[model samples]
Target: MPPPESSGPPLIGPLIAQLRLARRWSQPRLAAELCAVSDVPTLGRHEISRWERQLRVPGDFWLGWLAVVLAVPVALLVEAATRTRSLGTAPAVVGARSRSALLALAQRWLLDPGDPSFAAATGWLPPTGPPTGAGAAPPTGVPALPPTGAGEPPPTGVPALPPTGPVDRSAEVVRLAELRRLDDLSGGAELSGIGFSWLRRVARASSEATPVGRRRLLPVLAETAQLCGWLAADAGAPTDALEAYRFGLRAAGAAGDPALAGHLLGSASHLLASVGDPHGALVLARTGYAGCHTVASPRLRALLLHRIALAAALGGRHQPARCALAAAQRAADRVEEGREPPWLYWVDGPELAAMTGRALVVLRRPRRAVALLGVGQGSGRPRSGAVYGGWLARAYLQLGEVEQACAVADDALLDAVRAGSPRAVTQLTAVRRGLAPHRHRQPVRRHLALVAAAGPYLPRPVTGSRPDPTDRTAPPVGNGGADRPGTPARRGPGGRTGSSVRPVGGRPNGGRAARRTDGRAATHSETG
Candidate 1:
């Protein structure tokens, strides 16, 4: 067993304790229940006590049994275990100090790839060819990409394609944009493997291209990296997501697109803020805005500014956050259709309103938050609705509107279930905690029971094997360093817990419902 002192903040332990307590079960009771459910009589009170106390982490056997007895998803327990094991060890510092170092980090992420086993288990397969249109269905029976080793080339018989000119590049970008739209429909958990596969293919193609061709392909690679990073973060693989963002930043720099680089930086900043590193998030957000302020399109500028506003709010810089929010609103107002990059397609009025509302909630201006968040709530995206509505519910709670809070929370919970977003669920968890004092109310009790019933079926974070983090690179910012993923809770101003909102990326048609392969209605998924 690992030393108790080095075990960081005890993710699995707290999670186990929370679940156990939620059911009003003591250590011996939980152990007995586990043994009874799994037909294994060996587990006892001492073992359960050790696991909850962080003296010893549960192994896979116990984890499986615990999931069964506790009525939670096994994947949740698995992720908690992975995070617990990693917490004690210092994260490998893959700082983006230089281009070469960044490339090395990218290579390491490429080598690790996604968890193919999980992908297979979930019955998700990457598309056989590039996405063709908004309604395109991913073809079935495509063989999975073979695993590769360090310094090894891509799988045999899969030769890298030569880079093409503007027309082909545009086609690739359009294809990726379509994929992004698809992601908005299906949650990241479903498409993360596909995103990684696409990134690997594009990275390989870029590597083989001549200098001129590479320049063309580099932008595509950068775009692919952005999408991959966004999906990875949404799926709760923060390490992979960070690596993808860093790789994209390098590619965007090499392609000489400060706007694209800024977008990557802003995306990374959003990831950092979500994982509880507000200081680092603010630094990167400021850096991104600074880098592209002069050249970014109206929509991109708004997106970047919004990132800064959100980061600042999370970090407790009230005045700066307010200023950034105002600037972002102005930028959003000036957006011209068809004038922005394909990647900025999701940044629009409603999205901006949602983000601004989230900032206001963080600032404790619940009344204003309710108004802006209401406008944002009109976006039909299920995941966005779940997330923003959870915040709206919190705002209601702050005003002591228990009935309204519970009603909104009920809708948010339904959306969260439909979207299959872990972040949405986590956000709702916070809202549920906020409603604890009102549990005596009928509405609150109904919502609480609903949430409890839905817990096991909700999607859990899909984590892969940990990456090698030996090298450090200082990303574009001079003094900023890579923020560690999975930090413990951070307290904001006035003793409020720092909360995170989803990254910027507007879904198509304000998250209009899409059709799935089975001809069923498709709901919006988590963006970051």
Candidate 2:
């Protein structure tokens, strides 16, 4: 077989070495941490040393793990490595002892207790000096700032993305239609709002133009107004997103697009699950799943079923969730092996795996769940960021790896902030709950304090009693002695529940529904 041609960029080992140095971690420490948290168990310290020495190019799994653990994007790692080669660093230059010194220095800067600044500040430091050699150069092929029209200096840091030209109304209409399909599949409401806002802004801006422009803008403008509802719903503002979807449906009816209207309704049903109304979510999912079967593509129908399964799982109905997931998988399999409609483009092998993983974890097979979803570990798509991290957190928690679970949960929290997703917030809260049992350990206690810090954004459950964040006292860890006469029984999900999972929704569904919303649904109207 012929050798494969290099495509987008080169993967250089020295760059990975340099980044590891920059973080101040020894090869062993990095390897140990990754192995502790990973789904696959093939890695070890010696193997990591080999990769760092350029004896081997670590495959996708290791690369992905590095991306998450280092808290840098995959593209940045690739870019930094190529830039290093352009500067001519030897591939084998970084070694155990040299890396150890760098790690020691980094630890001093980031974690030294003797330094007063370290005591006062969070666990990061300003770069001590300018970057050297290839690392000093600007990232390859990234554009420099264009001169401002008014001679105003360009804003600092990265340049703004180039502006798109006047809206393509037809394309906007098509995209709006596609957004509904995504909503139906994901059961998230923000999809409609995002689509609606994008279209509305375009349509309103274009409406004042000449007759031809107005004609060009009308369809897009109308679609935007309709889309507001779905985006609202997905973002947890169900009532508002619902209104937007209904308005869009009315427009579709007027446009003689029964199929489009059906798709919008289906999307609405998908979002009902996010509001603690799984039965309603299922009703919506089934309605959309069956309705999409007629005018929607097979991919879209499969997506609808997937959302139904997710809702059922979250609602604590295992049977329907399994059935829906199975049907969705079957439908997904029927899509031609290599071909898919544009509307169905987002559904792929990893996404299907992720949805199935979520269901299985809820079904109490977290080990299998991690195995199924771990394929996405290093895929580097931002859209899968939350699910990928959430699955890892869940798996680690289930496996009784408290420290690893906490770290993964931290990753999930950071990803949620980047994605600006409230659902991510709730999921992270569930992870925090899972870590609560270890609150007496210094690191876990520190993590719990951080969880309390997120209270303003992640609002705690209103239905049940919880330890006061202000208490600042550690929970008892280790096996409980013969219980005090009046204390509640210490029940755990699969025996790990004491530390992770909470009573929410006025009851604990064996710790699966760990986030409580005080009987009030998150209305996206507040933030969407």
lDDT of each: 0.60, 0.46
* Candidate 2 residue lDDT tens string, 137-187: 211222223434444543442222212566666666566665545443232
* Local accuracy of candidate 1 as per-residue lDDT tens digits, 5-64: 111222566578668877988888998887676545655776565455343455555676
TM-score per candidate: 0.61, 0.48
Error of 2 at 524 (Å): 9.5
RMSD for each of the candidates:
19.9, 28.4
